[model samples]
Target chain A: MTSHPPAEGLKVHVLPAPFDPANVTLITQGAEALLYRTTFLAPSTPAALKVRPQKPWRHPTLDKRLTRQRILAEARVLVKCRKEGVPVPGVLGLDWEAGWVVMEWVEGWSVKEAVRGWEKREGARQSEQERGGYEIEGLLRRIGEAVGRLHKAGVVHGDLTTSNMMLRPLGSGGAGQAEESGAGSLEGEVVLIDFGLATQATQEEERAVDLYVLERAFGSTHPRSEGRFGVVLEAYGESYKGAKATLKRLEDVRMRGRKKNSKDYPPAVLLLTDLEGTVAPWPDECDSRTMHDREEKRRVPACLQPYQKAESYTGAGSNPYPPHAK
Target chain B: MENITLPHLLEHPLQVCLFRNVENATFLRQQLLDGNTKFEYAFLDASVLLSRKHVLAACFRAINDMLNDRLKSRNVHSEIVFSLSPNNNISESFRRFGITNESINVLAIKVGGDAAQIESHLTANVKGQPAVFSDEVLAEVCDLSRIKKIYRVDVGTKSDGEAARKEAEAFVLGSMALKGS
Candidate 1:
């Protein structure tokens, strides 16, 4: 599928080296990042390359720092999930210096599309009985299990939306079968995607908020299937040992109201605080021993250490010969 | 020589040759150490290789790094060997994946070389039986114990063979992609 045209002036910046600009297709543009469906390693192996473009409005140093932190944070979380056997995309490759990450391209439709399609078909047929049947229940259960697995792994997807979750058909099953089965069938494994806003937290309040966000997403996106969302909670409650407490906390979160707007805080700032601790106090000082010392404690992977150091020293300094200049 | 153009890099074709029961491994290592231009190739120990994908992943990484001007080693040939390693140490990577005196099966790779020239060069330098560079052949020579040790994967006893191999491969690819980070 062809992606929407990228915002003005972003076309040149988002393209990485070694890839012909002709081959890169912009999949979607979000506030913080642009999703491009491209090939990685080989032309045959499709990958989703998310590029956090350098924000011209912000200070160059701050922009670079945030871009690096968010890219690394997302890659780290995806790697952690893959190792733990969570049904998330494997991180294929990443270049923090370029502000991009290439992940395994999942082949399927989003849960939002599938659910809406199902609801539309069911509404037309007035099949209330089939609506609450095993097919939909199974889908909800899988969604619960996937989310539970994420939480169990100590990660919370800060933004939980149906659009962010995909319904990947299982084991060689064609997408044709999923489409043929109608929207209500709910056939396929629920795979979570777009962990850009995700964080590593096991706190009850955080988990509750995560669930509440999904609940709100479900209610707004698929009102017809709103009644069946409880099935998701039922399966989630039994997914892990701590899930029960998180469910109990969800009640309190609902009463208190979901007030925190992720948009209020700079995405990079939120990601940095979540992944590491506080942002380095001195953005200007090239040698922040405390920053490096703290990062070292976090076991910053060997490959990323150099970039971290470079970001500290250079901090938004213009490249002597930028790739685009060539 | 089996000349193949990997998916992403159509311009830089690779000439590959596999040899089993190699007797001249020490001489091959010496040639590489002396920086002989003709011997500029990735001479990998086949026992450490899991499959065609395993070797190709390293090749892909090396070429990708070279294209991005991010070579951490001397050249793309050395970078290919470094790509196989899960850690960041360059010499350690060469020791783990590159040719050694004790290497019994060798997978020699030369990028962008004449197919006939590479085949003749490989034939003259190595004393071994030429083997088809295929995953099936590599499977027979691959030492699971050594691969596990090098990659540090357990492949737990309870898991079936297919599942265990898949798990190990997933871990290996993840490690390769995250080698420096």
Candidate 2:
């Protein structure tokens, strides 16, 4: 009966005040937030509504505080990123008391969908598929540049994966073709989204960890194209003055990850059944996190790890901004 | 007068009327400052308004905050003017975004009133040519330099056209949304 009713009998389906159910359609129901596609300002302009419903499992005050803090944090980072010219969704509106934030609706397919679609089509092409190499590689470079720009702006996205990146196609057909074809063409700008676990940090370790997380994400999902990730590193190395140093630090982070993934370490207790949206824990929650690096080194399916050495990128000059992880 | 009913807040249907080349700016602002109940409308200087969406967004915030009893100003009308600001300074917001004695293009917004009655009152009081409330008209009236200085954006340097305008609008809306947070 109340807006903040006990979670035992409450359903998040009931949107907060000012949002009519008839107007907003459910986009995706994530663990914390229920994303909705709705029009804002005018009927024609689309926007994303992220609502953090009460968690009945936790204490009411704590749950409310967490919800408020996270919603504000995410909004703040997004605004800061936008002001700094990072390609992220701009915050259209936010209501911390209502546990909701509305953002500009990104119109394009996810990089995950695009890359997977291209891979699927490549298999179909058999031998002649080599021609598509340039396109896919270009997409990788853009991803690298996007992350670099994000880091340059002094925010680290804790969870970095292909799924978190969007390919806003250059042509007029981007949004129209989102659901139809991810395999069609890979020409677009890489816009990062879902900064639920992002932090405002400039430490090299945090930045390395961000890159390391992305590296693992790519390695796990698209093992066949894992080596091509180096192109991402290369482009990132050149994006800004501090990018090269960050790349150098990425090697140390990778070494530590490899050490953790070694065969003798607790027999890999962490089993991620669904690799998609596997969030890299925030620094405070690192102890409770499950890190599954099973067969990380043993599964060497490819031969060329060319350009994989991040040390070569150390020539990046010093920058005057704060920096973030994978 | 254009009767604009936002999708979500249908209960608060707005009666909006835009005016161009206002002949008496000082008289209108005087009524607001004098606290005339008859002139309890959001008298906005249309030069700072980027688009129809910008005006709608401010209205949405004002009305929504009023519904939730979170209004920071005198009333919803004043709150609408405050919402247009990128920061919290109620009176300053009034000075910057609100109608001033020098305002030429003025936009009159009434949250919920009889369309014909409000139109008649505005026509009788305000001395300006009534213009359709549209983006094209707003674009013509918008002073880009003032907007850039207020929002602290490089909207002036980038001449990439429509896309750039939309991007600037996005930042402005974002700033307004995150104003009090």
Candidate 3:
């Protein structure tokens, strides 16, 4: 599963009105955004809040525009899925201007962690030949069905990793026990999450790429069950009306390969540099003390001068959301 | 009177009273139109309400907006009525969800008011039999066809039952939360 260090200074950034900073727990800091667990509406009701911080490396206008657009797009897709009766988190609340989207927290472990945990326990108890059990196949089928429903709703999860899908425990408030004992049960409904890169597309190629991404994720993450990956496609074929056509397109997606250079830098790093400009002086080829004096002397590289001016302009001038802005 | 401290906004307790057959809705609506401070309660038409959760979701939205200083309506009480709407039209929301002369079953709500005072005021003003503000009572009073029409929910495919009601409620909450987005 994807993991990152606990956000050191995220509380300061996230603790606005309504949300208590102490109540916010950093769940994961992915490459794109930070996932925080916090309460919404009430303390008893949990929510997953995804915050996309400002990117200082990019032009501030472009950064603000992208953040607002992406959050709204994700929220729109989730609202669409919920309306279509697809199993996904409902959009509880969102602030595109502030760059946060709060979603109903699905209670369960990720499919990756669950399946791997199950495999480890089962392997310890049984023979290697019997490792690929019916439970594993059942879980794969559920994943396929969940993806099929998502595609049927005319949405494609651009990054379809096993980690993005959660297996929600059947009964309410049973997540703790389910994790302790039935962690490897392969039961419960599969609920999809993390729609950061999701888009509304019904194209066969897009659908194929979605499945292919999952296939690659399953193979890389759970090699013990790699042979049974076909079961996922098999069940997916029966999920919706045109699922079979999408599966046929998966072959072409596979042949063309999936590795394309995508923007992978975390926005936090970009934005942080904008604030401090600590890294800008690195290419000056000066010693630490001299660099400090040189920085004050306006000796910044000609290439870096424009970015320095943009950072200051964004810092003191631009307000992304005006007073009356929605 | 039911004093409900909705989940997040515990600071803003609500004084709610549901009536089965209100006779003075016209007077109550007139008081609101005149901006009388005494009639500051949200006088909602119960026919449009679906369940306790439905009412609570609207309350949550209004209170949340109040907290955020983003209320689109005149006050929290009117904001509560507006919150039930699936669209952004302010006056249209008041017309659809707010009390009118013809409204019989009424759901009276007052935010941050004394429960006893609000209850007694509602009882004296509204000539209606007091009813329990429960889902069962709401189910009986709710005009489902009118609700689906107002919200533009396509009920043609959904079979009539508790499941369908729950689905509709989910849609309503989603739409309310997404208002002005």
Candidate 4:
């Protein structure tokens, strides 16, 4: 449906478009929306605007409420990330109905593309004077460590993939070439993006699923999965040194699920509910199968008896990770 | 203060009104109190020699009128206005006026000094913000003679101090004349 001021009267902020209409260019079109690169005249700066459909379907009552909540939640996540020195865009504007946000656009390639090119360059046997290859393994390790920091802060990104990350010049003052090899470790600075699906999680289950999703994403997208993904785990282990027990339990959960013979993958929402601090209420329209599934988990086999005693229980099932919550 | 630009002034909740006398002002106050409207700063302008109740009522009515419109609309609601006045309760007044997170603007015109002081006060407060005053309001104050006389004066509420009212009217009408012609 075409977006027009509704009969109820569309509420607009009355601010002029920051960028000249002619200057704004469409960058990408995905399932949800289209992105545009625009230059906001006030700050004389470049910004990115994500434009979503604005008709009734786009801003349906339920979707609008959810979208508004997501925007607020993402802004809060970004604020937390910024405080912890994560490199994400600075939010400029939030127009909920318009489904648009203006943010300081970072100029860089995705980590996914960076890793691919790194491997490609290394195999080419280029001259030493040639443009140095971006350290692919180091980049993955940095991503893992960043995720580790996030989990420490009690946040599960729900979606964490290389495509959602951006790598820029490592504090080289501006967007300049790499001057020193170790002066700015390529792994030293990486920017995380897209926290739309993120939620607070204090349990190992939710955090583990988040990492699992990323691992699977990497395996599917990147050419070398085994060795490259190992580097990511090593760095993650270093960052989450105190929580090895939790990681071990996550592996156990993965193994158990693997043997279940169920082809259906559980949604992240279900996993988030299993986290200690996360308490997800059943969906309003949950079917009979979900009710049965809930009943099944409620049974709690005695095989988990010794496991339950060793862990400091958080009422139901406690995570065996670091006892202290950040 | 510097001139309030159209853009910046748009950020605040603003309102404008036209009226004849004390009765109108009184009527307005009853509505505001009924509507639970409040003002941080106000400029209620009417002839001092006339009934004080009507002038106050008109100001309150104008404010009440502002809130009836959609709170989220770009146009200012007639309910409240804001300036950088140090009124202690002005912030609270903003809430009473139904202005959620928006800025506030209100004015109470003093009688008998230079009526033009209203313009100066508005000018000072508007510093770098924009305000849109109604043409009808300008006509009621006798500022605009060029626009064909539209509404017959409601005789019941008309006041005697036509000259000072004319001076106040001139500011809005005069600016419009320059812009239109």
DockQ for all models:
0.23, 0.73, 0.23, 0.02
* lDDT digits (tens) for residues A227-262 of candidate 4: 468677777877865456556665656555542333
> Model 3 over residues A133-173: C-alpha lDDT tens digits?
88788889999999999999999999988888888888645
Q: What's the residue-level lDDT of A136 in candidate 2?
A: 90
Model 2 TM-score?
A: 0.83
lDDT, candidate 2, at B2: 94
lDDT of 2 by residue, B1-181 (tens): 8999987888999999999999899999999989999997999999999889889989999998999999999999999999999999998999999999899999999999788999999999999999999988998888888999999976653256567677788788888988897
Best DockQ among the predictions, by candidate number? 2
TM-score of chain A of 1: 0.72
**Per-residue lDDT for B1-181 in model 4, tens only?**
1122111112222232223322233433444345533322243332111222122222322332243332222223322222111122444333333222222222243221233444464444332233223323333443222112211111222353543333232221212111101
Report the TM-score of the second chain of model 4 against its true counterpart: 0.24
lDDT of 2 by residue, A278-311 (tens): 7543332232233244323333222333334444
Q: List runs of model 2 lying over 4 Å from the truth.
A: A1-12, A128-132, A171-184, A258-326, B157-160
Which residue pairs show backbone clashes in model 3?
Answer: A56-A271
Total backbone collisions, model 4: 38
Interface C-alpha RMSD after superposing true interface residues, each candidate, one decimal: 2.4, 1.1, 2.7, 20.3
Ranking by TM-score: 2, 1, 3, 4
List, in order, the clash count of every candidate structure.
6, 7, 1, 38
Docking quality tier of model 4: incorrect
